[model samples]
Target: MSPTQNIVLITGANQGIGYAVAEQLLKHENYFILLGSRNAENGIKAAAKLDPSGKSVEPITIDVTDDASIQQAADQIASKYGHIDVLINNAGNNNEFTHYWKQQESKEEIKLDLAALRQIYREAYDVNLFGAAITTEAFIPLLKKANAKPARIVFVSSHTGSIGLRTDPSSEFYERMSRPSFPAYRSSKTAMNMLTLHYAAMFKEQGWKVNASCPNLTKSAFTRFSDLGRSPAESAVNIVRLANLPENGETGQYLDENGIVAW
Candidate 1:
């Protein structure tokens, strides 16, 4: 694919790995980067930094949790860009991580506050899982409009979501996790993987490419504790690499910086 032939949209592009990806993509001549953020202020600020003259980097308001917001953003993108070459679903949240774990412990790991769990699930699933699904559904039409190559969708994911890595006895992740039922965070990512596969299978059958990627344990403000993790800029390398894959590249698998992660 030509460097200028793609228009890339990255959700949660205000900071962290998303922002880093924006920074890197801006350096590539002819690639238009849409910086998606919940906050307009942060979005504009990030866009300005990526494109000093505000020509290439376009700041767009998008809250993955809010359907109305997502629709509005989709409408705008459809009208302005006509086609989206690539989409990176990077928006996510973990606000209810601590409480859900505490309640699960109180229930002898058997029960939880259904209301609270639903609320937490709504936020996490909406952003990490459902948001990506909606974005894909909304923009798929525009993607097909692109005459260059099959539209690509890259789901930015985590190793925590890997059931294989979580259950492995010798894996570092299995040893480090403290919560027994911390499924809210981990499961949301797992759901993301499944969604990636669902799209991958469908796209593959239709001869299109869609994939998921794990940045590993990247050090960022999002996590309360992080050791042996790379900086946001460091982690962004793999995400960018996967996003820019050739049309015929791999899809429907979980990957990290080095290569594929088992299941």
Candidate 2:
């Protein structure tokens, strides 16, 4: 690693917007990309393919649902780099990509299998929301070890998690949506946004950049039947932009593709 090399760890980076963020960040000569995936083989394969030049990408196994895995990864990074420049909590779950509307009526009228819902919620919340929080706790020591200033931590969230947008009748996504009763995914991300705020407040006392980002409704497998709008490459822009910001960047704010979202 160069003296000025910056290490960036991105979770759930085997595919989708996570992969795109890794790909885009590699253009910078100073970045050492840590591709975090539950599958070690997939992470290695993605690292090899995305960073064929081999100087940028480094694959690391990280199953966010597993506390042991998170601790192991954090320990390795802290031992190797002494500090992490950026941490992108990009991993999320969407209820096995089930079409909630097709399965049931409204969130209130739906009669989902309690066991199934709990199972999905356990994995999704453990990984999507709590995973970020645990990772932040484990890595804060390394972040504070910086020689000069504090580092950046980004939570890759979605607009579907936004309370303001979800409740707004006049908004563009009022009736055409199908987000019925599946509180696991949406609620997990809502918790993620709050987790972002909590971390941001903690880091603000130490002068670090920690914020949440709703990457918008990007074209991905997560969208299910929705029209493909923005590519993962495009969606990665908001996050990487946040990741690469200078020390003066915003913190504790929820941002979409355009600007801040009302909490």
Using lDDT as the measure, the top candidate is: 2
**How far is 99's C-alpha from truth in model 2 (Å)?**
5.8
Off by over 4 Å in 2: 99-111, 176-181, 224-227
Candidate 2: minimum summed lDDT over ten consecutive residues — where? 173-182
TM-score of each: 0.87, 0.89
Candidate 1 per-residue lDDT, tens place, 132-242, comes to 889888878877776546667889888888888767877666776434655777788888999999988877865566778887666776754467667888878877877
Residues 93-152 of candidate 2 have per-residue lDDT tens digits of 777456464455455655558787678788778888888888878777877875435588
Cα lDDT for residue 234, candidate 2: 83
Residues forming the 10-long window of minimal summed lDDT in candidate 1: 95-104
